[model samples]
Target: MSTRLQSTNIPSIHVVIPGIESLKTSLESISHDTKFEHEKDMMFFRQRGKILIDAMFDYHPIHLMALFLNPRTRKMKQCTNSQRQSCLEYIKQEMIMFDAFDSDTQS
Candidate 1:
């Protein structure tokens, strides 16, 4: 007789929120998982850093606005909400651009 694994037993998908601690942990995990002599992974890491730096500069204004209107401040919820929306829109545009670049490379 064959047995089946239940979907509930499987791990659910999770979206990691971008934060300094989370980013550090993620980089450490990636480094640990990469085996020795993995030049490709090293190169990929460098490329990823470049992309991140580029995105940082591209989104600097949005990020500055978010920081300036941080939720931790008293009664800044509205500013925080606007900043969050701007961030989401910026990320969406970046994703679309990345997808287009990927398609062009694949072709």
Candidate 2:
């Protein structure tokens, strides 16, 4: 497990996010010898990873905007129409708020 997470790069989100479903499937299919001393711990890890990946499907719109705007995920095939709209609105509101702040600071 330590070997699996040795590398971290933000740009890898483009590759990782798109393959989450397949990774979840692989996690769900994991099986170890029942007699192993740490079998239960291994199973727990698999279950927890699956749960987190599944929850990513319906994550907050703002959280998803990063995926949507990423060059490698611009198609946003994973997101529903409503999620896209929510992200758009969220960005617009944030832009307006930031503009107001910028003007205030300038004054």
Highest lDDT model number: 2
- 1-107: candidate 1 lDDT, tens digit per residue: 01111245542111112232244345445445445788677768866875675466333544434443445422323234665567567767877999999999999
In model 2, the runs with Cα more than 4 Å from the true position are 1-7, 11-58
Q: After superposing candidate 1, which stretches have Cα over 4 Å from the reference?
A: 1-79
lDDT of 1: 0.48
User: 19-68, model 2: which lDDT tens digit per residue?
Assistant: 66457768888565577888788889999988887876646555567767
Candidate that would win on TM-score? 2
lDDT of 2 at 88: 84
**In model 1, what are the clashing residue pairs, if there are any?**
none
TM-score of each: 0.31, 0.54
Using alpha carbons, what is the TM-score of model 2? 0.54
What TM-score does structure 1 among the candidates reach? 0.31
